[model samples]
Target: MHGVVLAVLLQATMAGGKHDYNAAFKSADESGKPLLILVGTNWCPGCVTMKRSVMPSLLRKGKLSEVAYAEVDADSQSGLAGKLMQGGSIPQLILYRKTSTGWRRKLLIGAQSEMTVTTLVDRAVEQQAALQAESAEQSVVTASHVEAAE
Candidate 1:
């Protein structure tokens, strides 16, 4: 019984909760990962489905662990929602990559099946890895050029 209770508690704690847009962006920037922002209202059925069904499956598969996940309530946090949306619809899933200028939106739109969401997340991770590698190469080249100049 004690073991069972401990397992349940651990699961509950590991499961993520709702987050704001800025917090999500900041986390992604700090971690060098992408941001997944779910924008919707409490009253939206699709939003509830996304939170309960799709997100959990992705989490179980460790798809979202590499990125920051956030939820913005459309009705309650209208201002933040609007800014994140930029005049988009509710139940929107926006994926942003951290860049020098800021977090640049990569993908924007609805919740998908577990497979689809996983695939999208995987693709984003691959893209981020490539970008980081490219940046590292450029930095090395720049350093070599500076050494030659000196």
Candidate 2:
């Protein structure tokens, strides 16, 4: 049963895959992966540039081949923007990573090269792995305490 679940999850994190903001967050939680979010509005040229050129180029060059990505419209998702940011900026790449305490964010404002995005995503994934390991260790400790009490 665990093997089947692992296999399915392994298939899900093929990298460079684009999902919606909600899906990206869910995927990160489920697969223990990090999210690469491109925050923008429909009218923002920089956002369009990253979407139509930079990101697509990165995808074509296999730069983002190991991370999950999402393009979010900050203007439309005002509630999300208010919660996540002080300034709603376009073409901002935000990496949302899960930690033992909560979510950690790495923000890159404005347009970035393929390498910049790649490096950030890689770092976020590494951090998330550490967080997950810590959480697993805590769970083990908690379970042992419960067993000892019983």
After superposition, candidate 1 runs with Cα above 4 Å error? 1-18, 86-88, 100-102
Q: Rate the local accuracy (lDDT) of all candidates.
A: 0.77, 0.75
Q: By summed lDDT, which 10 consecutive residues of candidate 1 come out lowest?
A: 12-21
Query: Which candidate comes out best when scored by lDDT?
Result: 1
Q: Write the per-residue lDDT of candidate 1 for residues 36-103, one digit (tens) a residue.
A: 88888767787877877888778787879988888777776788788878566557887887665666
TM-score list, all predictions: 0.78, 0.69
lDDT of 2 by residue, 77-111 (tens): 66766666546566788887766677778888887
Name the 10 consecutive residues with the lowest summed lDDT in model 2. Answer: 11-20
- Displacement of residue 93 (Cα, Å) in model 2 is 1.0
How many Å off is the CA of 70 in candidate 2? 1.2
**Candidate 2: clashing pairs of residues:** none
